[model samples]
Target: MSSVETVKNSPWQQGARDALPLLGGYIPVAISFGLIAVQSGFSALETVLISALIYAGASQFLFIAMVASGAPLWLVLVMTLLINARHLVYGPNIAPYLSNSRWWPVLMHGLTDQIFALAHTRLPQLEEKDRMGWYISAALIAWLSWIVGTAVGAVAGAEITSRWPLLGEVMPFALPALFLVLLAPRFTSVQWTLTMLVSIVAALVLKLMGMTNSAIPLAALCGVSLFYLLQAKLKAEGEIHG
Candidate 1:
């Protein structure tokens, strides 16, 4: 490659290095997905395909769980889409930084929660010309780590289950545990705490009201709306007092 190409590619390497910490966090959660997928009667191939194609960690867990329980196909599709609707918010936030590259579609395909979180916080610090390369590189590292972790988990799942059935039963909880771990640090903020509480209550109430699969989407909508309203209200009160 020419020196020009090398200059263009350097940001990709930098992005990979920056995302190294995320890889440590991703591996165990992805391994759990693979293990649970196989335990839910998916072939190793099917498990990997779901991880590769769908690539939504939380939704994937919900997908396999619902499918295992014999939920209708339409419901499964709707639920997965509902669970991932939050990505719409992430997309617009990152769009201006995409560098208008021809390869954006490929990069966007793998934009997960962790990728978005990192990109939103770090991209502005990057040189304008390097933002796309860094974003893509970081996202690719995370994607590959998930896929590799899933493969390892799928391969080892059978032996582990055979030897210790209870441990296999515990695998599905990993997704929830992972979320708790991620959210723990953020709970120091009142807004985040309120959002979490609102979402949980709304989801539970909607579920009790016979909304079933629709509960999550509706609840998330309510929580986000309430959060914004609260923020606006606070701002208004502060202005009045000031």
Candidate 2:
């Protein structure tokens, strides 16, 4: 490619292009969320604002559900924080590739589970100077798609669902399907497989026990903690054997 072409189709542009597949998942799920929020008595504007401001997929659904159920704001806040605490791990893992960019704190707003997964895989292969641009591009596209999807859902979700009831049922699966797509490639070892199986079992058990609200976060914590503990054990055994 010519230098001009390269500049025109920069890493930023590539990132946005790479994020296009996310729209298929993000839009439908976001629309579902918008519909649910609106049906739950939130105004269309509030629905859009929630997607724009919070942008925390499943957590937003949980937030709306909690609010509708008259859960206290403090409890809602705690649950939201607990669900998103995985970001602490995500941010640090991606920070090295950011090359100490001053805009990181601001850019971090765009971080999401899918974005983190994509960045973890792609960033290391990018030129140092291109990493931030690519990240910003991918994040921006994903964010905008979500906001637009929410708006559509807030405005017309009921109509859409009423016309195609099956869509309403299927929309909920989009998020989980997207997650499986993102994580499937990483199940490259016994450890990863075991961690995922454990997490799945934990989540299922929690849900069966009527701890649905805590299942996701607790299960995620269980998986991550187990992976780390396994890693530590392996390192110790390797040192002793060496």
Candidate 3:
């Protein structure tokens, strides 16, 4: 067989290589999560466990904030579920592309926002049978990188924070900065622009109303719904005019 075929058949090798670009982004944020968690009073073990179990950078930061502040369990539960609700949207979109392997469920564990973005954008280029293997390989690499980065940060975070308090203060901003970087590309579209405006307003309002943790999900839900509504309205208007 050809070299491309040989490499493609070994999904793990292909995926690991594909996943490298994402590391420039993922490693720093994962490390920041670990650093922030420990500085926020989490034990290194607890911090590592949070990354291992939660596996979501934004939600993990939110969880650390809530737990450090001693927020109510009910509030934390509500916030966590709401914040992760976007995954519900992600799963259905990806389901059709995935193979019917029994390991599908396990593979799905690696479905993060970034991975999903990568999958939808990149997977279409691959042969159908090879897509799942590549996706699973990419996912596993990303997941492992996150865990390792978290472990590194957890072990060294507290000491680093103590040595350079400014760095600790800066750790919390890393996730938000990363998100802004991700969102920048989408800002060119009118639909995305409107959605961002509405989301920003909603988040600010929620924060003012003392529902800080609830802001992210609520804003996202509002923005997505508004985008769909606007799109439908424009489509209907075009049809009538046509």
Candidate 4:
């Protein structure tokens, strides 16, 4: 390939480019989040700050909903933390790939679901020296997109939505659509399939029982526990047969 193509395909460029798909999803969802948050009675500044500080996608919406319902601050905090508990698993799983980089701690702040997903698939393909730069490039782009999108929605979301009601209806689906895209490829194994099924059932049960706040974290915990048990059982069976 030509030098131009090589330059275009550099790890940093590739990282930024790879994040483009996530950007497509994040921007609209973030915009929707901003509009919803503002409509829910948050000021523009408050909405932007939430996006900047918390940076949790669906959890931010949940936070707004809980607060609007007059739920206590402590409950909001607990629920938000529970919803984002999966980050604990994400960090450890991604740590090995980033061991050589001193900046991983700072970079860890950018570890959202999409970034983690991208890192898992893309980091292994990059050279060691290139991984940090690649991650930084991708994470930074995604972060900026979210922040910018939020600003746009906060500043003009009311006007925009008034003129285009369909956008208001459709934008909320962007986040879930993005998640489904990320998850679809992982359904290749029975372990993953079973784990997800269990998680879904746990969530549905919790939701039905009026325990929606605990559903996400509890379901995640159930899924992770089941996956480990399956792995252990498989290992034991192999040993016994051997």
Candidate 5:
């Protein structure tokens, strides 16, 4: 009915237009992270090595900050692992779609918010091979750009630090903003709106009750199960009305 809808329906289009956002979304965060990594008193090579290997951006930022703050190594690990536990869920969820691709595990190691959300929404229209190819291309390009961003930041971070007292300090909050952006559009439904409200309530209750460690997992469980039950019940009622 519209030009945008027409493009979305085209079979020949590769859907790479959406990929442009990832560069801007990732550059500042990655550069800030690289600068922080270097400034945490780690050698430049050390920062380069770890950022390349441990591309889990959030965990890397947390680890360096905790070390800088003199927090225990074990405490940092536990917190990082907890924060990154969502990746564990993502692994199994995407496994079915990627199971037949060559070296899917390697491709999966590059999965991030942009790649995962884009692929989930865009890939079903394309063939399996193309789906895998599109996702890998998007994710890998984003990763390479991140490394370049970090390099630039490492070189410029000192200037920023002198001016802003650690502009890189804001790097840790970027992933949460990324998460919110990815999921924000999906909140258009009433059920999803309620689920988010419930999850927030549950999280606050758990924190106030001193079950802080359990807050995230419990909130996730309550939200997902409630949404699933509501959907099922609504479907059954629709069937009866029909």
Candidate 6:
């Protein structure tokens, strides 16, 4: 192979290293999804299909739960889409690295919070192409694992959950917990920290007011936009002081 080809194909250990902790977190959550699907009236085939195809845990949960509760099809569709609205922010944030990759579609579809956090944290100084490869490999593995694990859980779900009552609750907490862990290093930046706090508080406030997932998109926009303006004000003040 040409040196250029070799260089392009060289493996990034950082991606796999970063993905390990994430792999630990997603295992049970995937299992939980499988169990939930079965209990909620989905067959094993259906569970695997949703996990592999829909591929968004929270949205799938909300979608199936709403449908099982006799929610209108339109409402379920809106909720599913709205719950996943956060993806809009994720794409452009990583676009520079991925747009030039050999596998843009794989990166876009496979990338998840675990892989995103891992790559973003480590790739500040790496070339875009290297970062893209690192992130895509890890994210794709994670996505495939989730589907595979869900399929396993679907097969043994009744036995598994019966022995572990907490499975239902613990599995769902995985993603949120993983996010908190990922956010730890970013606390050094006051502006970003404040922005995250504002977004969280806004989401919770909206939830308290009985806003469904549909309204969360707007709440997040308002909160993040407000933080951006506030940060600008602070930067202007700092410049004047300087």
| Predicted model with the maximum TM-score | 2
For model 3 the TM-score comes to 0.68
For residues 5-55, could you state the per-residue lDDT of candidate 3 as single tens digits? Answer: 234446667777766667766776777788888789888888888887888
TM per candidate comes to 0.68, 0.78, 0.68, 0.75, 0.69, 0.75
Each model's lDDT comes to: 0.77, 0.84, 0.76, 0.81, 0.70, 0.71
The number of the candidate with the highest lDDT is 2
Give per-residue CA lDDT, model 6, range 1-242, as digits (tens). 11111233344565555565565567677787898888899899999998888888778888779878999999999878777877777767766554454567555777564565555555554566577667756776788778877987888866876887685566556667666766676666777777777777787788888875545566668767977898899999999999
Backbone clash tally (model 2): 0
In candidate 4 the C-alpha lDDT for residue 170 amounts to 65
Runs of candidate 2 with Cα error greater than 4 angstroms are 1-9, 166-188, 200-213, 224-242
Give the Cα-based TM-score of candidate 2 against the true structure: 0.78
Q: How accurate locally is residue 117 in candidate 4, as Cα lDDT from 0 to 100?
A: 76
For model 1 the local lDDT of residue 213 reads 57
Residue 140, candidate 3: C-alpha displacement in angstroms: 1.2
lDDT of 3: 0.76
Tens-digit lDDT track of model 2 for 127-147: 898888899999999999999
Worst 10 residues of 5 by lDDT: 1-10
Name the candidate, 1 or 3, with the larger lDDT value.
Answer: 1
RMSD in Å for all candidates: 7.3, 4.9, 5.9, 4.9, 5.4, 5.8
Comparing candidate 1 with candidate 4, which one achieves the higher lDDT?
4
Instruction: Candidate 1: list runs displaced more than 4 Å.
Output: 1-9, 158-242
Candidate 6 off by > 4 Å? 1-12, 164-177, 201-223, 235-242
Q: Which stretches of candidate 5 lie over 4 Å from their true place?
A: 1-16, 160-189, 196-219, 229-242
lDDT of 1: 0.77
Q: Judged by lDDT against the true structure, how good is candidate 4?
A: 0.81
lDDT of 1 by residue, 1-242 (tens): 11112233378887887667676667767778899998899999999999999998888999999999999999999989987887788878888766777887667887787777667656766678888878878888888888987887898855654776665466546544544544555555787789888887898899899876568668878888988988998899999999
TM-score of 5: 0.69
User: Per-residue lDDT for 162-225 in model 5, tens only?
Assistant: 7865444664455455556556666778899988878878977998998765677788899999
